[model samples]
Target chain A: MATARAYTNIALIKYWGKQDPQQMLPYNSSLSLTLDQFYTETKVEFLPKQTNQTADSFVFAGVAQPVSPKITRMLNLIRQAAGWSNFARVETENHVPTSAGLASSASAFAALAAAGAQAAGLQLSPRELSIFARHGSGSACRSIFGGFVVWHAGHDDQSSYAEPLLATVDFPIVVIAVLVDQRPKKVLSSAGMQQSVATSPFYPAWVQTAESGIATMSQAIAAHDIARIGQLAEANAMQMHATTLSAVPPFTYFAPMTLKIWQLVQEFRTKGLSCYITLDAGPNPKLLCAKQDAAAVVKKLQAALPQLQCTICQPGPGVAYRD
Target chain B: MATARAYTNIALIKYWGKQDPQQMLPYNSSLSLTLDQFYTETKVEFLPKQTNQTADSFVFAGVAQPVSPKITRMLNLIRQAAGWSNFARVETENHVPTSAGLASSASAFAALAAAGAQAAGLQLSPRELSIFARHGSGSACRSIFGGFVVWHAGHDDQSSYAEPLLATVDFPIVVIAVLVDQRPKKVLSSAGMQQSVATSPFYPAWVQTAESGIATMSQAIAAHDIARIGQLAEANAMQMHATTLSAVPPFTYFAPMTLKIWQLVQEFRTKGLSCYITLDAGPNPKLLCAKQDAAAVVKKLQAALPQLQCTICQPGPGVAYRD
Candidate 1:
């Protein structure tokens, strides 16, 4: 048995659409910041072949759950690489706060990739692990590295892997995720992105601009320009969401409350606050702010939105094997 | 003295960015449906040379006001065309309901172009009036015609003008304007389009797709395909708004309540109601539905949102002189 843990990440320069869906290859490069607050730990144990077990089993949060196809596909790839055929029993423990409206797929898949590869007796490097995790979930590749990470939009599977832009951020920055809605997403990320790629007239321009966004974001991180970093990330997130709006039968992730929180963020910025907002494919808005200003920002946000659940997070470490 | 009245129009395929700001030439052709419910009437009287007035005077809704530069520029064009130079006294009255959150520029400018031309003793055709109105506001050109109108994105002053696509509609179609907010717009249409043209990376693709959209929209109108018309209009409006989000310093016109109404519309459609929504540069959302579905749709919308003010409009007449 092998156990590993990986923290979740929120993209600054988002990876929205895929160039190759079969291989899970992105059309544009992406950058993200790994957060210490939310993560998943997984343990994979290959059952003895002498026992009569036909398939892998999954237990999530101490509850027996059906093994998802994604998990099975990931394990199949690991078994193929190791040349070992065995049904593994996987147990995952998600550490994310309840009803946060944040997806834990990045941490879940990254931890699964690490533990499954080890349990199967494969001595894969971190880079190799990132590549393996990508097949399970595209954003999982970036979770293999901590701090600021860049997932290159390489032409093929062999070349596309995540690398650390900054392994650990030396500057004072904090991310506050504001949970806006607890309902399940109407459209899953994969399906929404597929529709965007197929129908949006602006999808090609999004891919082109996102490539350049990575370089600028990296420079901002190097310079420790918190405002510039926040600006770029906010704009990039908006641009990513814009593609969905331009899709045929246009849709949006902006719930009424989501827009309310965004307006508050902009209002606070005008009131001399150093905070910027970014959103994923969900309605929740994440604010990037300086560490010193986090408390004040949180206080004002709570005051403005009494029902809001805000979690502050700092930069976290890369995936690591526990046992 | 000459008086003329013109009704407002809401674009089905929106004209967003300007190719030439100086000439107010659009980057893409657009289509709009002229609505009868809201209109503007203006009376222009050229002062005699003996009056010794050096500048034009203005009165709006019984209050004397300053003449805007746009009004002056438009009047100069009329004077130039007629070879008659004289200061004019302009009195305008807007007929829209209070706090409708709708811009009356289309009706206002079209009436001004018609009345100003006639007061200056210029015998101008409706086509000539459309070209004259184009100098005041881009969309005003379309208000010179009734029913379905198409404003060609021509190269220059002489080429760009509004033409009637379908001057009269025999089908059963009704437009419900939902006044979601009464607050003034933060970004004016002209400034918003200018910023979009200057910074949005997706702008080029928007221009390309809008050209084809115009053709498809025209065909849809010709067929009296109400569903197709609504689908095309909703998608086109979303695409136009998408450009704003992709602009530098990303912005959106979607207020919190606007999104709520949109979600409600989507929900009602899934419940077998035939309705689609389109938004301009502000928070108000317009619903396009068959006349048979109008009462039911409005009833449900009002029940769901008690504060919503819904105005039902039909196909309107073109610019006409009053007296």
Candidate 2:
């Protein structure tokens, strides 16, 4: 019986823009959390000795298709990292809302990394696993760990890795993630941030600023300073997106209703709830608030910002084996 | 016959975003240079004894009319700043290209400050002279000097001040100002940047990055690092404008033809000339190059992008007595 592994990623400070495209060395350092509630349950069943099994099969969201070039490339990279050779049927059941512009891939790819390696029976530590996962997606490496994970921008490929953090000291912070848009983005993140980096005059400056923000953010998180962390993350996200504005053909991730929710959130904040918000590559806002009021908070947001479907996600588990 | 004192204001970097609507202190810092050619020939004649005379009048672009309340507010600012006891008739001429979105008021109001003071028989130093001008327009304070000038941030009604800069060394760089569109902007500067500053997640990072950028730019200009200066300025200008893209209602300063000129300029740059371009409130691009190559460069641009009537200007005299 083959076993599956699942993981999820939560970035304390997110990464955007690339220093190097091929290597995926980010311009700024980032931190994340690997969750259990949301994950990609991948079960790879190796097929062999059959006469005509030439192509790999992928069943994602009940859609069966031959492995695409991009997915094939990711599969090859994982195989090369693990040194395994076999034809397989790979299945990914996404706990995250697909194409909602959420960090679905952050969890999906992380789980895939864990399950893919385990099915191959290759023993891998979290650090080694992180490096392997990074080959698939930059944010996915951070999802290999629980609590908090910092993606370290080490000198070369070998040195760069993410570490799991146990900052249970500040567990009061609850993340209220609202899935604002369901439409798929017109451009992929790789092409999007790249265009902004090359064309934006603010990009180099943003990169350096994000580095400083990273240091400040870690300290803030360590100190249990929710406001500071939220503020820094909010600022960092804006600066990262500013590069997009300065790109030759300007594009923004904000949807039409984003402003409505943002304003209401700010208004609620003014009423003394000790809350702030941070956004990543999507219009959906993740509200940083006290965990004691997690359930009630979503009710308030749903009533106030009628355009949103808010979900309250607490700190989740680390990467582990499934039955 | 009244004498007109004209001054040309060159944006050292550029001004974007307004923090306060009443005072118009920009969210970001901007440096500028005031020259003699593209200037505002302004004269003020104080008629203390005439009780029936109207307030200040502005003849902009050969169109004469009663001054609007906005201009009146600026005049009241100038009146309070100069501490003038008598009513005065202000006649002005703008040498800055009409509707090009270059720095017109910088020179126009600088000359107004100078000519108003001169006509009032108030002998004021350049620093003292800038007080009256800053009220008229934020950028106008920089026009008090021909070289570099920095506007110091100040708080409400009392402490605000600006002064001319006499740098140790200055260069005569050619600016081929290209005009793209003459339409007045839909959103005003103060309204635009304020919304952007308050809302843009990318703004805080830009603020942090600009600190280092501005510091380096000052040093580069002082060291006469032509390439460095141009590169920094281009980056700075682009970053400054990037904030507009994140505004709730996004604003664009680009004209379609601006891209054509930009492409041609990039082609020239690839040919190894020490030429770089900077843009501000309009679609026009101001190409910075040496005076020696100004003619040839203009010819090259004309051949490629002939739609624009290129105007070549240099570091001329500061606001002063002239024919």
Candidate 3:
């Protein structure tokens, strides 16, 4: 029987706003790239016989600790339906630095999903697997696939799901990770989505316009059109951040030096290098350019914005079994 | 004598952030269309003997009252440097209802710019007029022309000013205002922008990507392509509000009904008719479409969404002399 499985990191080109907080239905359609190289090695065991009043634990990178209160509550809710209340231990090991905030939740949840199913010995489809991972972090929905992926915004519990593009990427795809900081400088917690949903007036617009962007983006990705993908990702990412900006009381997660690096990255594009940038709640500016220009773009961006250390990586495999 | 003069209403296609809040020199490039129907009537007569000590009154419609204390300070700031302490009794009326919350200030100051030039006996070029008007509102800079306009992001006092479109709009345009509500909303009033400037981690990304959107939208508008124009405006507006959502407090101006009308409007386009919606501040949804289909679109929209009352109008005349 197909049970638990580990997924990889997914980046949404069309994302912003969350609808049902518990279920994590996004307000817009989002495109993502599930990568290899980095992942969360996780195992989850759900005990139908454990005691009801105990707490859950998350041991990340050999450090044993109590899980986040919110996560504990979510786990409890899921288990409540099964009439099992004993504690579950979640173990996650990162291929990358745990403190760097390299979107570890995407992988962490993917692993938990795979391991939880293995422990429970319950079979699940890709859609069920995607929905289960969504309980962990919304972006995890895309981690179920490798290569290019798109998350469709369906209305109900059975409606929303993610699908992968079978088309090959002929163009060179590269991500130059400019390391501006070694530690995640505290972004809006995932709970911010729920808060934003309740407060933001711009959230509906974000939801209403998701389909067209997602549809166009998937086409651009499938065609291996670097420019279109970059353009769509940049706009979609910006839209994601913009929805947060329009949220009631308003919030932002930016580093002062982030702007300086962004300028340097775009200056290269404006100089006609065919490069574009995407960011996710961090000061580091990721440079997306052709495989031919990848090294040059990294070197040039490093020279221009020396504050951010650069690391070049290509698209790799999705979540899979380890030898 | 200070007499009535005409000015256009400009809707910017690409506007991201403000470099100087006091002067409203936006950080991004923006394009606009000068409408024919919407205009602000203003009369400016310089009282050479009036001193700065007395309060200058700003009367809306037929009511006469002293300017608000906040505006008094801004006006004083403008007057202190120019040595134009003379009070001008500027009376203004607008086609867009005062409470509708469209950027009516753009028209108010654009007309004031025309009347101010006439009253002050200064034959300023469009750039000079823009500089004077920008002191009032950033959107006012593009309201100087009859067709299309662009505000080139110039740095500092010397280079910054808005200019009319080098290329005019090729298609006849009409705007249908579906009145959702006339009451002013409780949005952050850009307290978020100032806060995000200080707090947002993505502000740099916001600035870096703005130019491309602006440049692309400019070309789209210059070509008079409705689909491109509509796409860019919707995207650009959403981008602006996104930053607001990410502010530390997180907020948005959207309501449930706003999305319903938006869906209906976009549904029209999907049905082979041309109609696109853009919204600001209030819950109202404004449709931009061709003149030939505008009336039918408005009627259809009204019938479709009775919760929203629709009014039809066209691209207004340029700033002109009135009896």
Candidate 4:
């Protein structure tokens, strides 16, 4: 039995499309920053084969639930690598706020991969763990390391993995997660990515730009230039969303409130505030700024939008074994 | 003195980037529908050579104003074509509603081209007039014809001009112009197009897709397929805006109110309303639907957003002499 915890990450240079969907190989390199506020903890216990229990059992938030296909596929890979066929009982606890519109898959899969591998009696390094976690979710590999991490878009499964650009952030950077809508996403990220790759005329440009974006972002992080980092991340996020808007049967993750917040961020910048916004595959806008400006940014946001729920997060540690 | 009036147009297949800025040659062909609701009338009189009146004089909306560079550049082209050096006095009347976000350039420049040429004693064909109008504004060439017009993206000055696709509409189609914001644009359309051409990585794809889009739109218009037309127009408009969002120093015309109206339009469609939306380089959105559904779409839009200003327009005639 083993339990592991991992923090969630938000990509600076996004990973939108995949070159190989089955193998989970991305079309371009991506950079991300792990956040301290939200995370997941998963415990895995391998059970010996028995007559009655022939499948994996899963419990989420203290409620027994049927094993999802994603979990099953992830476990199959683990079993194949570890040379074991034993079924497992998995329990997960998520710390992400309910209805926040933020994705928890990164941390959840990272924790699951670590705990599941350990429970299966497999010894692996951090890089190996990141590669294994990617089988469950592409961004999961980034969560395997804290601070700034880059997931290299390698040609094949053996070469693709994430490495820390700055393992311990020496600068004072902060993120304010602004929750806009609670409704589920109309288009899932994986499905949206596939559609973009197949239909969006701008897909090729996104891949080309993202490669250069990763290199520039690495320099920004190394120099501890918060403004440059924020600008690059904001541009990359907008470019990723642009690809989706041009996809066939066009779609956008921007809700009305999301646009409102985006405009407000621009207005804030015009007023000499140093903050920039980034979004994932959802309507919520996350503002990245320096730690010194966070309080002012949050106060101004609340004053302008009294009903908003804002959470501040800082750089966090990578995945660690709980037991 | 010669006076001419030309109706405004809305592009179903947009004209964005330019392949040649000096001659105003476009990157791809575009199609537009001339509308009866808005128009411009201009009178040009070539003044005899005098020491005191050395340059052109201009009056707009009953007030004398300094001649704009666009007007001067357009007049120069007319003078060169007519083999005359006499300065001109131009008067213009715009019927476009004050603060409405719709552009009047297509009609305004088309009328100027016709009136200026006639006043300079140049007898030119409609195609020749369109070629001259391309000097003032790119889309102005499309205003030379009625109903559905195609501005062919020819390689050089002699070949690029507008021609009537379906000079008379045999089917019922309506456009509902939803005025979302009254603020002036932050980036001018001409500058925005130039920026996109220079910076956007997706521009190559845009040019390629637009050629195919023009061909498909021609087929749809011939079949009188309102749904297909709306779908194509909406996708094309979104793709055009997507390019702007991916440009260096990315910008978007989507104001908060614009996004709200966009969501409302999508919701109306989900509830069985047959309408699609397109936006230009500004925040206002134009919803296209069958004539039978215009009233219902307007009612639903008003009920959802009581403050919205909606204008219903149909296909209109081409440019004609007022006197």
Query: Using lDDT as the measure, what is the rank order of every candidate, best first?
Result: 1, 4, 2, 3
- Deviation from truth (RMSD, Å), model 3: 18.7
lDDT to native, each model: 0.91, 0.65, 0.63, 0.89
Q: Which ten contiguous residues of candidate 3 chain A have the minimum total lDDT?
A: A1-10
Summarize candidate 1's per-residue lDDT along B1-323 as a digit string, tens digits: 89999999999999998888899899999999998888999999998888989999999999999999999999889888878788999999999876356679999999999999989888887888899999999999999999999999999987889999999945578889889878789988888998888999989999999989999999999899998999999999999999999998899888999899989989988888779999899989999998888999999999998888999888888998887
Using DockQ as the measure, name the better of candidate 1 and candidate 4. 1
lDDT of 4 by residue, B275-302 (tens): 9989999999998998998999999989
C-alpha positional error of residue B132 in candidate 1 after TM-score superposition, expressed in Å: 0.4
Per-candidate TM-scores read 0.99, 0.61, 0.53, 0.97
Model 1: CA > 4 A from native: none
- Tell me the tens digit of each residue's lDDT in model 1 across A1-323: 99999999999999999999989999999999999889999999998888798999999999999999999999999989988788999999999877456679999999999999999999988889999999999999999999999999899998889999999955588999888888888999999999999999999999999999999999999999999999999899999999999999899988999888888889989988889999999899999998988999999999988899999989988998895
Listed models, DockQ each: 0.87, 0.11, 0.09, 0.74
> Model 2, B269-315: lDDT tens per residue?
77876677777766677877766667877889888767666767766
Model 3 off-target regions past 4 Å? A1-323, B6-10, B14-16, B48-55, B69-84, B97-101, B166-170
Measured on C-alpha atoms, candidate 1 has an lDDT of 0.91
Which candidate leads in lDDT?
1
Predicted structure with the largest DockQ when compared to the true one: 1
Candidate 4 reaches a DockQ of 0.74
Error of 1 at A193 (Å): 0.3
